[model samples]
Target: MVKATINNFESLALSGKTLGSISYATRKSVGRKSETDVAQVNLNESLETFSIQPQSGFDFSTSMGTKLKLVNARLVATEARSNGRTSVVQGVQGSLLPVSDPTVDEYDEAEYDMVFVTGKNRKPVARVRSKDAFDSQDLVLFGSDVLYKTDNRNQVIIEDDEAQKSGYRLNFVQSKIKDDEIGHLISIIISVDEYERLAPSLKPSQKYVPQGLRVAFVGNETTNWTLYADTVVPLTENNKQAVKVDSKPNSNTAVKADEKDMKK
Candidate 1:
């Protein structure tokens, strides 16, 4: 039996402020518990032994030559050996022992995979992969635990906070447009690699466009519709095109006397 205290109107039951204590009781009931169980039991023997202090903010684990942060860390890949063994590689961070290691519990990997610590709003920030191969989108994201690497041998590791906060960013190359899909003029940005991704469908042209510039869509006519960025639009009799201008048409020109007579 242990003696404890509860203050500040905080609950002391199994579902309340005492998780470790309840976990201990649960482990004792289950017969499978950690070696730290005895120390944890002694700590709970007195209320003072367990501090009920409130968390100030995000706290990272950086002990025993290991640096693990819930927000910034990502699980990269899990490998299965021929001997029926396995280990997980944490991108930018080292590997962890097999999830079934005697020192670690089965739920340990799941718990650390994407969990935010206390005072961290309990958000999942990363993704985990257990295989070597994955798709193109997975390569751009840090959450994907893939083994794919660039020519430089750098596996892309995205910042979870940045990905959560902002939209997906990519490095694109000049890609061609599908002639059939090119309808009324809208705008598009493409990279060369993106063009290749759409190959066999996209129509080929002689010249390549500069990067990061917006290209307006033109109709079925292929030759005269496309032009360089700085080219001037010529208002001609046969070719009537809508031009984007700085100012709106003058409102005074819209009022007509014939229109007023029609209203009466």
Candidate 2:
């Protein structure tokens, strides 16, 4: 048996308060049992919230509204390789360790891949790939086929938490993957400008395909689930057109002249 793995962020630390109840969900399929315990926490640096799963049987005694800092947390992607060229993605593996820390925000802060951590002017302390390959973003986001969209004036955390910026967020499933058929889904956050520009075309009456900025663990590397584009760029119309043009067969290519006639 061969092992396949990838590590992008070696360390992930965040200080935030619990947003909602931490619940454990049980998912059963065929002969397997899976734990779907997820924690919804709000970032202390801002009001942005994200759901992350924790280790099994973790202590959840920490009640809501308590200041917590994620400790010993990292993002990893795994795959189980069998015979040559035969393997399957094992999904993202890692756990969030939110330890109570009341003074987490007391320290001057820095940003890494849009995630805030304690300390001032702090750069990336650890990375999986070379500095050029991985800096802040080690995740790729691509989306198509709009499932749902939020209010355009809603606030989303793309950069530092600041007031007065408004935009929209939507869940876009990859055009190639069916949601019911697979568990792959991507959430895209768009700037207000992008939203306004695409609003007319996005009417319910119009046929629209949306692609935007979203973070997702991808099997970009064979050995590990590491390496993502520097930024999550929404797919564009020109790009779509280019694909269609490129995929079509060339009509100008000359064909062989009458091979059967020559044989006769």
Candidate 3:
């Protein structure tokens, strides 16, 4: 997996580092924020301030699946650091001075300071790396402990197609599951295109799309599943053209007050 820290765009723009390099550096620095980390500790009351919302009614199961991979733009590197070096030079008296710098000859590793933001009002709970321009996704699980603290029903699924592209495998995890076999795994199958579409729907200030894409679990059972498109297409009557109405005559339609109106 490619690594990218917060302030990724600025780091890429000013310092000229690739996105992959930044991600690599950020993942190594620190543990991501937990749900409790963002919680507002109740000082006055012994009980923690808590609230709950009824989950919207929807079937949350899916079939085993695979899809095409997304493309990521590599930031252009402007200033490249030399790797740590080892060199020898003669002193004033022609005495040889051996110098050793372990990483001096290699590219200098990029550094980033982090910014922490608590999830509030439905925003994602996450730990972010910050910079002058924007905050990048360091780690994000969810908004509340109730979401993450529970036994996660998420599963990661990876698939391969032999006929289409040789040696290319598509990876996508089921978002919400019924009987999860694998332990909770972060779903990383979001395509770059999906990221672009979902980004705007989130708050204007929101920068990170942690999952890259959102997949709606569209069926009542795992076998009856279909991956909807990236955009949220509302279920409007126009799209329901094929939806069947009961052919059995209803009294309202059959027993029209005026026979002439029904005849037309």
What lDDT score belongs to each candidate, Candidate 1 first?
Answer: 0.20, 0.31, 0.19
Error of 2 at 89 (Å): 8.2
135-248: candidate 2 lDDT, tens digit per residue: 212123332221122134432224344433333333333344343432233333444455556654453212233221112333433222212111133345554342111111
Give me the overall lDDT of model 2: 0.31
Compared with the true structure, the alpha-carbon lDDT of candidate 1 equals 0.20
The best-first sequence of candidates by TM-score reads 2, 1, 3
What RMSD does model 2 have? 20.2
Evaluation by lDDT, superior candidate among 2 and 3: 2
In angstroms, the error of model 1 at 239 is: 29
Instruction: State which candidate has the highest lDDT.
Output: 2
RMSD of each: 26.9, 20.2, 27.3
* TM-scores for candidates 1 onward, in order: 0.14, 0.27, 0.14
Q: Model 3: how large is the Cα RMSD against the reference?
A: 27.3
By lDDT rank, best first, the candidates go 2, 1, 3
